[model samples]
Target: MAGHSKWANIKRQKAVVDAKRGKTFTQLSRAIILAARNGVPDPSGNFQLRTAIEKAKAAGIPNDNIERAIAKGAGTFSGDNHSLEEIRYEGYGPCGVAILIEALTDNRNRTAADLRVAFSKNGGNLGETGCVSWMFDQKGVCIVQGVVDEDQLLEASLEGGAESYEMTEEETAEVVTEVANLEILNQTLKDKGFQVTDAELRWIPSNNVEVTDSDQARSLLKLIDTLESLDDVQNVTSNFDMSEQLLSVSVV
Candidate 1:
């Protein structure tokens, strides 16, 4: 597995194990409502909404809350009178670790002010919109158990239009595919009973940057934490790779 990719997994586990339940619920609900409002209310018709609901389920979000969010978004229920906008921020973390922050906000100015402070306080600075976005390519990412039958997976994923599949002995496999084909491939794999860890659109780094020192590592991790704390920040992606030792300490 890619070093950074492994670190991301570790962090994800940490989130499930130690994160505040309410915060996770709020974030998941926001994602569901936003996706439904912007795209389609029916999960079957909206790929992003489907993925958001799946993720919310994985996080233990209540079905009632999920449905309520969707209704509010679809305008069948009372809403709090706020509009959401998808925003992206590009920047460089400590040691020049390229970063991108994806946010869903009701107020751009408030979100921007909070995010700028988060970056500046953490030894990083937010850049102009296009500053670092060009360094990344949007792609479909699927991580599954590495122990799954490779031959069967290769055949199924390929036949389902996957671009590539890579594995590690740690029971983890990373599958890549064209962004446009994500929904078809994900639905097919899930229908065939493959254990899908995560299926989503990700901003993949065109080239990775390695962080070699403990000081730099500490700084980059700090920056990640800051960006993650924003209520409007749905997810943050970075190209900084972590060492095995760092993986032991950095869980999200």
Candidate 2:
């Protein structure tokens, strides 16, 4: 869990950089669309939609764009008829580190081809579905920032049905719960005056492969970056662990 906690912290920093470059807008909009399409368009009535909208707002997305995405998802906007479907892809990276990807795509063949190329070009290979998925479990994660009392957070989490909570960084804490209890735990934290910033479902690897070789570390990171660069990829998860020092040098 600590390895994943470290990875999550790095991702948070990367997201800030990505947002400044306007690279997160497309992904954020797609999330809003999918949330709205799966449930009600109104954020107040739909937890997923509300979470997506909050993420978009945090990324500095314009209200108009957010509304347009919702309209498209609800099939109320004129001439926008594209339907997106969520799919999961599995593969192996350097050192047999299992990798799992979640994507939202309108064309499966195109997305598959794009992923195949991304993997093959970066020292990995796209494998059949379920090949690596079995190594992980899906859990809901809620991130809270600012200094917080560990005891208080633990109590609140327990009351909200959270399974575990940990401080992933000096000022950031992550609370994990069952998929169905995510909404409850998020609201509970907010009610307790915690500054909850993000909430989403994440694949948690049951086991991890440690990468000490610098070359293998570089290849793994490159494979992950390449996979994430694809427009259709929503999330990429892998079961690799490396030291922060190695990670810093391996980001080629």
Compared to the true structure, candidate 2 yields what TM-score? 0.95
Quote the RMSD, in angstroms, for model 2: 1.5
Whole-model lDDT for model 2 versus the true structure? Answer: 0.87
Worst 10 residues of 2 by lDDT: 1-10
What tens digits encode model 2's per-residue C-alpha lDDT throughout 52-117? 999999888999999999998898989886888999999998888899999999999999999999
Predict model 1's lDDT versus the native: 0.81
Q: List the residue pairs that clash in candidate 1.
A: 11-251, 11-252, 146-171
Model 2 regions more than 4 Å off: 19-22
Weakest 10 consecutive residues of candidate 1 by summed lDDT? 243-252
Residues 123-231 of candidate 1: C-alpha lDDT, one tens digit per residue? 7888898998988999998877745588888887887799888774366777889998988888777777787777888888888888777767877787787788778
Cα miss at 116, model 1 (Å)? Answer: 1.5
